[model samples]
Target: MQPTEQPTKTESLKVAVVGTGYVGMGTAVMLASLGHQVVGIDIDQNKIEMLRRGELPIYEPGLEDLLRASQERLRWTGDYASAIPDADVIFICVGTPPLPSGQPNLRYVAEAAQSVARNLNGKLQVVVNKSTVPVGTGDWVSRILEDHALDYSAGRYVVVSNPEFLREGTALHDSLYPDRIVLGSSSPEGIERLRQLYQPLLEQTFTPPEGMPRPANYTLPELVTTSLSSAEMIKYAANAFLALKISFANEIAGLCECVDADIEQVTHGIGCDQRIGHRFLSAGAGWGGSCFGKDTAALINTGSEYGYTMPILRAAVEVNQRQRHLVISKLQRHLHRLQGKRVAVLGMAFKPNTDDLRDAPAHDCIARLMDLGAKVTVHDPVAMPHARREWAHLTYDEAPTAEAALRGADAVILMTEWDEYRALDWDQAVRTMRRRLIIDTRNVLQQLPQHSTVEQVGRTTLHNVPGNEVLAEALA
Candidate 1:
């Protein structure tokens, strides 16, 4: 095999990103915007074609415009043979969905690594694992590469772990204006190469794209350079801690419901402490999405596999799952016999701004309501198609208006905190409902609606109270 030249730190090197999922696409665009030539490869030819046509398959705010702007520097292809061999850096941002046993299904990641190895052109490319996988996956990919490498040359390539910390709705924003950049590798050269790749982002040197503007006081994100295992574990541990905070808040919210203390005030008091900080403390439906549940379960499962049990993560998962049913509990108390009752759950997507319905709280809540024989109708501004595919049995409001879903409904539960829901004209919508009742899980609508009885998650007023049990008296 002929020796290939490596890139200098100042050079705009060729970059290849595998899998065009949320993480992959965002990373590719962000890198291209930073002046690196990026070739985004995916197995799905349709997705690649969509990207080629300047049509973004997934929905993230300002991602379409950013993709359009990056077209000059970024190319989309379905062929790994062409994309992998020439790149100076390869980011494996494929999906690592959890298995039945809570271990990550690394089939996609393994396939990507094997193919990258098979297409090795003796380049000193750094293969960075951006997928949130179990700890030690960097070494795992390194071994797989050695087994499948056609060149059989040492020092030609190195594996690094660079886990992504992107939220779904604000993925593009998160990638562009990151809080921190984490790179994990043992090899100094590999680490240096990856660092060079992310140096622009770490330094906040790039001009902001049109739709994605930089914050006025935006500081360059802290760069955390560490071992492969620590990087891998950081992604899991960070997500677990956030999920734990949310679940703990909900647990307190449940106690608040019992004792009639205002959970909003409680969480506010908790957030007032300088040590706790004020983020992820909102008491709401529950934490859901691609990361939280899957990663926490994987962390717990990984610990169990090594003869250690993670009670905190396990309890976090339990609390999040139970938080969904609490909505059902409220519904049961509100309307005792759910049999033949009409119910509508507003906002079907896990969180607002994205159509990703994987492990959404609406799934568990609506299922419980339906199990109690209540006819459940669901509404979401964007997730209807995906929701229909996931829950085909449930009635969906095909119309563009939320009123179509709320018309003559027994009760409405706000699950996802969507802008559309917050902007709704409840004045007229309440007139169409059979009973003007709302179970607001997201805490978006603060004021009392006219001609409606509303029960929010964290507020002082508990639902279905007896005559003598007022909120203030119970709190006292």
Candidate 2:
């Protein structure tokens, strides 16, 4: 056993995580680190091959190391038949991508369940839904399984709703030291089996990886065991609420700028109140990731399905979409028109430390700049390759380094909050660019040379101050 893998009272489970995407790969490695024998199955042969060679298809912090440390207990294969038959616990972590109507396309989820069902043996199995899915999906998976199997009566399986609450960059940390673990199933046997499977994490018995210590005052991970539907709803509710808080903070930020108040100071003041503990209270170029946007839209769609309208969540979604334009507006204030001007956009990955560009705000900002006829160049420390391959429609020059992106640029927009970007020499930026206008969407940087002009989204600066009328005009 590796130093990271400790002895557990719970028997080492034969675990299978379907889909080698961010969530599935993270969960698979995490299970291995907890002393579970894991097989990660995916339809993509290339991805499976990559995993077998100890390579990652995607970027995540501390994941490669964890995968290396735990690969002895982990297996990878493209064939579900080979992977699923012997699995004690199966985690369905496939993508539930958003449809054109904003409802999740559960085709992948259904397909994954069907594939696993055909291979289900007589051994009692726990099928866990680790994908962020709509409510009632557990029952839906059960029905699918029944439909797939002619001998459904032979295989006894329990569908457990256990939504993952992991952030992209910090997935390893979040999975091991989760704020809580939610398991929902009507079957006592299934729930008990899952409870035992997650015993190491729940009891915090596993040793932390090097340089990643348990928080000084970390408490035991709360386990919320409830009905399947409630467990599903909790995932949507949690994401929608976090999205709402970020939107709320951005909404308040607009008011703060017009009134000459700092959003940082205001949020800090409000955050002190225990009722509003500050976490997602950051006002930035809105939010983009695998979660917030899709989850919020799914929640709103769910409401509409039940003949209910969530006005607050709808408003939150609206505000978040508009928040990205604030960067363009700040740019306009500096350079009268975007046409023929060269703009440098820093940070392309949704947030940082991960190469996931799913709905990244930088995408929208750059697309809009392209529409406005601006000659745009971009740079992200890690995500540039994905941006280049996946976003060929976005025909913009990319820089190898942050300084190269800023060289001779008319204006700069800081989208993602990478530490390397935060540590950039502002004086060097001033020396490089033709015009040193910076719009700090994330409010990450602190010090800058006087020659460089900086404007943050949520605060009032002399260069980009907005009066009540300007704020109203912005709304227009």
Among these predictions, the greatest lDDT belongs to 2
Candidate 1 wrongly placed segments (more than 4 Å): 1-10, 393-399, 462-476
lDDT of 2 by residue, 389-432 (tens): 88889869989899999898999899999999989887776678
What residue pairs clash in candidate 1, if any at all? none
Best by TM-score: 2
Considering summed lDDT, which 10 consecutive residues are worst modelled in model 1? 1-10
Give the clashing pairs for model 2: none
Question: Cα lDDT for residue 247, model 1?
Answer: 94
Candidate 2 lDDT for residue 113: 95
Show model 2 residue runs off by greater than 4 Å: 1-8, 462-476
Error of 1 at 408 (Å): 0.4
State the displacement of the C-alpha of residue 189, model 2, in Å, after optimal TM-score superposition: 0.7
